[model samples]
Structures are given as structure tokens and as C-alpha cells.
Target chain A: MARMLSGRLPDPPAAVRRGPPWAGAFPSTLHDQRVASLLGIALGITFGTCFLTGLVSHFMQHPPNWLSWPSRPVWLYRVTQGLHVTTGLASVPLLLVKLWTVYPRLWERPPVRSVTHALERLTLVPLIAGSIFQLATGIANIAQWYRFHFFFTVTHYWVA
Target chain B: MSGDGDGDTGARADADAPAPAGAGLSVGGFALRVVLVAAGLAALGYGVDGLLTMPRATRPSNAAAWLIGGIVVHDVLLVPATMLAGFTLSRLVRAPYRAVVQGALIVSGAVALMSLPLWRGYGGSVDNPSVNPLPYGRNLAIVLGAVWAGAALLMIGRAVRARRTGPG
Candidate 1:
């Protein structure tokens, strides 16, 4: 009765009482979910294009036994490759800005809240590693930087 | 992640409260989460399998190094450095021109980073005119010049508008 009258809520449960260290590092008006969602949507579209276009390039290179890609469109390969490179390029800023917006939350302590949260976070490990792999390798590939021993195309394909 | 490290002291009323126990997962959402994890693991496993089978071509060891290295390079070097630069630079600009300045920086930074490789011309081949044909360094300069020109106009317009509207 006294606590209710005073309008103070009870403390959070023992397991997850502390707030994340980076909760207030950024301004909400500028770096909230709205901003994150906007960048995420853009990344989704560009990365989707890159994915589909990547398949087209792979097929063109390998010439799959299952399906005969049309030769009628002389410019088909050109178009897909152009879109892939451009969209991949576009993703750099979107990825960077998206990171800029939400990277503050990387400091979350007590990293796992529950079993479900832990599982969800586990999935992100491959995701972040894979995406960054693609981005770095792709740029190196275009520049002929050859930073890795693995054949770029082979690794890039499997990862994607 | 209740990123509200600063506390709930009147920052912005009714912003997202820290997610509660269960993290607000509903039954359907929980099912979806299960599916997502399963699919992610499947895909990742497949990728690893492909890397392993083609030992010579893929070189899984080196590839794994690059994969983890990307995360490190981005998390440790790229993201923090870029964010800190932006944060430090933002303090120097006045309010009315802030958006324009930030926008120009982002645009030019992306353009420059994307185009730098081309300007370096390491990949350009004499036999293949298709690759890096033009003078990319000069071209990049022109693009940046135009970008700053547009930014200047935006800043002037924003300042004029701010002056007319009076202080908010």
C-alpha cells in the first residue's frame, strides 16, 4: 500500500536488473528505432538485389546443368553485374550509417537475457561475420587487392 | 538491451522502455524466432560444408581468418572511428547548417570510399579498356566540388530560413 501510494514501481527481477551501459550514449531524436528501420529497409533492398544478381553472375560463370540461361538478351549479364556492383557499393554507406545508428547498443552487459534472447543473439554471429566478409572481400576483389589466400569467388559464393 | 544508461531522467518521455521479461515475445514471435535460428544455423553449416569439401579452392583456414577479421576491422576500427569523427565534427557546426553539413559529409564519404579504388588504378589493365578507363581521381574531385557547392547552397538557405523564423 505504501509503495503503491508513493508511485514507485518495484525493482526489476534479479537476473536482469541493470540497464545496458550504452543506453543513453546517443540522442533519441536522431538515433532511435525509426532511423534504424529506415536504414535497415534500404539495406534489405540493396542486399536483396546483390543476392539475386550474384546468382545471375554465378550461373553465367558456371553455366548450370539444370537450366539454360537465355542468350537472347545480350546485355543481361552486363545489367546484373552492374546492378550487383552498384547495390553492393550502396550498401557500404547504408551499412555504415546503420552501424552508426545502433552500434552504441553493442555495449550491452549481461549480454543474454534469456534462452530465447541467447539463441537470437547466437544467430547474429554468423550474420555479422558473413555480411562483413562479403563486403570486405567484394571490395578487395574489385580492386584486385587479393588480401586472402582463398579464391574470392568460391568463398564469396558459399558464404552468400 | 536497455540502452538507457543515462537513466529515465526526463530525456524523452515515453520512449521505448526497456523490454520486459521474455523480452515481450509472443507465442507466434517465439515460433518465428525458433525458425530464424534454425534456418540461420542451416545456412551457416552449409557454407562451412562447402568450404571444407573444396579445400584447395576455398582454403577454409584463410577464409575463416578473413571472415572474423571483417568483424574485427569493422567493430574495432571502422565504426568507432567514423562515429567519433562525426561526433567530434558535429560540435563545430551551428544548428541551422548542421543537417546540410552532415548530409554532405556522408554523401562525399561514401562516394570517395567507393571511388578510391578506381582512382588508385591498380586494377586497371592496359589490354582491358573496360576497366578503369577514365581519370577517376580528377572525376572524383569534380564530384566532390559539386557536392560541396550544393551543400553550401543548402546551408545558406537553411540559415536564411532560420533567421526569418526566429528562434524556436
Candidate 2:
């Protein structure tokens, strides 16, 4: 409306053509790609450990017929379970740091430009919600803070 | 559908895209996406089916609330709080001291967060003394004291070294 009144068509910014950045488009060098990528690698290692070890521990407790629960290496369950807790604890820091880094992008303008863009944005719902849920429930469970109504084990498994 | 922690694949994909070879809609890339999406959907369906088998075992409504609450807590509380802290620190701290301060803050914040449940002894009970048996708060203080002390020493060393090799 202002441009129309002024009788001057505003030139489109180059960024208009490419689409929105997943990185927070704000000006800051600290949380750029390098830092994000490094934090990402840290998170990957910690979370990956939690997932694998948690799986082993789960299977040992609720051994299904399809898969064989390991009987040998007497310390197997102990080690896996220990690693699970350790990695999970470590992930608390890594996850929070990573979120802090990329959080600015959450407010990037024109959130979705097309069907594909919208779908991509939609995918973040699960990613964010799932990680947060896992950590919250896991922490609550470990702390024995049984304030929630749902059974932790079953819900945690499905969520995982 | 991505499960990776810090699951911002899009954030990392923006740099130097190999679009000359059609990284997005090339025949191979499209097929890969199709396979990945199919697998993700299948996993989703399987999870839903699995949940149904244990209705009483897992309270659906409450679990859903917790899931949603996690997002709320993160987006509403965590981000804003950190932004405020960062903005305040930027205004207060000088450039030369900023890195040390920031590094110290990050490490300190992470340690405190990871230690909260244990430090509070929320799970400790008369029935189980072994659960968080130690004085976590005191221990945490001791640990943080050491961390900060080390940081202080490092900063002093840097200052001293800089003085000895003055650029001016």
C-alpha cells in the first residue's frame, strides 16, 4: 500500500527467490553453521548411545520371542544399562545447547512458502516434540518423579 | 519423522548444495526420499498399533499432555530465558573476557541442569538411602568451585602471558 501510494514498485530481495533459511536469519557469528554442526555431532554421539543401550536394556527386561537376548558376557546388561544412563545424562547438555543455537530460526519470516516447505516444517513438530518428550520422561523416570499418570516404560518405548 | 537429536537437517543442508547434479529431484534422490518416507510412515503405523495393544499400560491422554508440555516448556520458557541472559551478558561483558565468560557459563549451565534431579534428591526416600545418597548440593558446589577456579587460573595465565609479550 505504501509503495502503491508512492508510485514506486519495491524491488524484490534476492533472498525472496531462494526461500527461508533454516538457520536463524538474524546476524550472529557465534551460532553459525560450524558451531551448529559441531554441536550436532556431539548430540549425535550421545543420543545414539542412549538409543542403542536403551534398546538392549529393554530387550533384556522384556525378551521377545523373535530376538535372542544375550546370555553371555555377564556384564553385558550392566554395561549397556550404565551406558544408557550416562549418555542420557550427557545428552541433557548437548540437546539444550543445540536448541539454543538453532532457536533463532524458529521465528524466521514466511514460515512456509510452498507445499514442500510446509511439509518440511511439519516434520519439525515430531523432531522437537519427540526429543523433548523422551528427555522429560526419561529424567522424570530416573528421578522417580512419578507425577505423570502414564506408565513410563511403555510410553517411553513407543516414543523412542 | 527424523529421530536424530538436534534434528535440524534443514539447518545443515543450506550450505553449498550440490544442485548441479539435481540433488533434490534427480531420479536417485526421489527414489531415496520415497523409500525413507515409506519407512517412516510404516514405523509410525507400527508404533500406533503397538500402543493400542497396551491401552491400560499407557494412559494415552496423560502421555499426550506430557509430550505437548515438553514443547511448551522448551519454546516458551527455555528459549526466551536464554535469549535474555545472552543479551544481558553481551551488554555487560567486554570483548576480551567474553569467550571465557561464555564458555564458563555454558559448562556451568550444562552441569547444573544435568545435576538438578540428583542435587535435589527428588527421588531419595527413607526406603532407599542408596538413591542419590551423597550430599549432591555440596558436591555440586565443590565441582563448580573447581571448574570456576580452573577458569580463573587459565584467564590469569593468559593475561600474564599477554603482558610478557605486549604487542604495543
Give one clash count per candidate, in the order shown.
3, 0
Give interface RMSD for all predictions.
10.0, 7.3
B73-106: candidate 2 lDDT, tens digit per residue: 9889977777677777889977666677778888
lDDT of 1 at B107: 93
Candidate 1: C-alpha lDDT: 0.68
Off by over 4 Å in 2: A1-27, B1-24, B165-168
Q: Which is the leading candidate under lDDT?
A: 1
lDDT of each structure? 0.68, 0.67
Write the residue-wise lDDT of candidate 2 on A76-127 in tens digits.
Answer: 8889888888888888877787777666556644554444444545656666
Q: What is the DockQ of candidate 2?
A: 0.31
Q: Give the fraction of true interface contacts kept by model 2.
A: 0.42
Candidate topping TM-score: 2
What lDDT is obtained when candidate 2 is compared to the true structure? 0.67
